[model samples]
Target: MEIDVEQYKKDLLAQGAEVVFSKTKNLTDTPFSYCGGCGHGVAHRLIMEVIEEMGITDKTIGVAPVGCAVIAYEFWNIDAVQAAHGRASAVATGIKRTNPEKFVFAYQGDGDLAAIGTAETVHTCNRGENIAIFFINNGIYGMTGGQMAPTSLIGMPSSTAPYGRNPDMHGYPLSLTNLLAQLPGTYYITRQAVNTAANVRKCKKAIRQAFENQKLKKGVSLVEIVTNCNSGWKMTARQANKWLEENMLSQYPLGDIKVPKTDN
Candidate 1:
């Protein structure tokens, strides 16, 4: 039977179904711990929605990386484990390997995943770990000052890059999706954002696809979400959104870079 995606979403909204960000039992109420205009909050909500909709709350184990979302375990009401800086993928691999029956997911920021955690992320995908990875790419490190992350765009200014990112000196920013796409173990890889309503919907869909792929015991699935950090970016929440829409989107084109036809 064909599923009516539109009607299904409407029903979920009408039933007062609590997943994330609604009034009752919403994930947002867990606390406004994230900085204003931070993409982590939006990403958090999408993950919660996917878990609730898939009914995998009980069987899911989320690995939270050491970055801005270091304490994501506290906000997400699921089996969450904290990993050392840039080691969430390694931890997630262990958990998924040991508990094959459970669904494992890893969440990490640009610095954690693309910089320090690069080896783990690549090896995990190379091994085809049956897990979902939610990667937040905000260009700058939001937690320990606004430093240049591996994903920071060219000419983008950060605390570490006072003048802006210089490819000659700092090297090119890493493209998480493009890098993972070269690996055969990666069943799905997509780049999404949360700067606008349309993009938010796309991010949720990408996240949902990642979860579904993991449930099917498929290879690794990575969803890189270009999020915002208003405080770190030194812009108001509204201005940050505008900046992302005007600048970030061009560098990080939105869409799935790879997905096995069988998985689709």
Candidate 2:
């Protein structure tokens, strides 16, 4: 006899399991346009979940930069603005300053954040902008083909680096999140992934904390999600995940880099 998966899920929900999975009200019902096995969808859902849970869906603003997530304004139910390439941080700063009561966040990709927006990112954090930054670090430029990004692994091959990246020539992979943590203006910074169910839960918690920090006016909060770009990596979804665990995790470990002081 075949097992009734749909009924099983219904049973679980009826049993008061508190919905192991459900679409957040903060996102549109339209299906996601991300490539199969892409982590952007997961990251989007997690952020929306946090916003819905916090009951701030109407009071939050998101700034999406030019990248795979540039269309975020269409997906997210809340008010969202599009920023020029690598300029999400600067746009978010202006929005938060002008509307201090609204919670503002910027969603950026590694290429947009670590390279073109480096100056804006550092300066915004240094100035203690009360905004959250959701950084998606997939190591490659997913939107513009598989090109090397500032956070790409040292020896990772990309369209631009067919023979793998040479640290001597390309320099080393930038750890922007870690660098941001060192700034006194930043109150919270963390690196997370969505490779597993457990990791997904942890990521959601970190995102929620970032939102809470904004409500407390605790300065800048940066949450870096080290995700997999299967298509850009030229690997199957499963293979990409495995490769990320073996290689990416070693260079960009998962954990909270910094947290707000309890005494404060």
Candidate 3:
């Protein structure tokens, strides 16, 4: 018989209404610092919810980066270490290597991961590090004055690219899922979004799978969230959602890039 996991979860929660779910208490009560209509907050909440549901909050160690999620350490009530700009992957590798028992996750944005930290990200995945990377790709630098990021879509205007991202001048956007899927060391890789209820569900499932992949010591797992940066994109929350549907979703079609082979 197919089990109703949602109902089961709800039943469990209903039975202990007064007792806080361990993960719920781990996350901050205040609204996130992310800009309005920003996908970062939605993505963060989903991941946090899954982490709580799985009862892994106590053992998880998050490595936060310098971009919009630099203060992730403040929101997620777990042991966390702050990394320099674009250095979350490197920091995560060190932490996981030193403390193999803990669940290590690295949270970073496009500017931090695809730009300054590209080498570290690629190398860590190449080395088959047992860590999960939650990459938020909003296509521009949200914290640092809306500069064009490596993942910025073509024709998307930014402070640096006033005329939009030019092919000859700026090159192309980076597809992290597609790029990392080719690596044997990467056990789980998926592209997801947080624009709607349906997409949010998919993202949460992917994130849960990523964490499970890490728990099994399979290899590097990455969940690249095609998020929105309303502030940086210079669009209202509603406009940002519409833009994501028309622009971002088309460029970054969501799906799993890789899953561990059972025989492997």
- Write one digit per residue (lDDT tens) for candidate 2, span 1-264: 999978998898898878656677888977888889999999999999899999998899999889999898788988999999989999999999999999999999999999999999999999999999999999999999999999999889999998898999898999999998989989999999999999999999999999999978879999999999999999999999999999999999999999888985
Instruction: Quote each prediction's TM-score.
Output: 0.89, 0.92, 0.89
C-alpha positional error of residue 121 in candidate 1 after TM-score superposition, expressed in Å: 0.5
Which is superior by lDDT, 1 or 2?
Answer: 2
What digit string (tens of lDDT, one per residue) describes model 3 on residues 73-165?
Answer: 778877899999989999999999998988899999988998899999999999999999999998999898799999999999999999999
State, as a TM-score between 0 and 1, how close model 3 is to the true structure: 0.89
Once fitted onto the true fold, the runs of candidate 3 whose alpha carbons sit more than 4 angstroms away are 1-23
Error of 2 at 188 (Å): 0.2
Give, for candidate 1, the lowest lDDT window spanning 10 residues.
Answer: 21-30
Model 2: worst 10 consecutive residues (lDDT sum): 16-25
Candidate 1 residues 157-225, lDDT tens each? Answer: 999998999999999878877978999989999999988889899899999899888867769999999
Give the winner by lDDT: 2
Pairs in clash, predicted candidate 3: none
Scored by lDDT, model 2 comes in at 0.93
Q: How should the candidates be ordered by TM-score, best one leading?
A: 2, 3, 1
Most TM-score-accurate candidate: 2
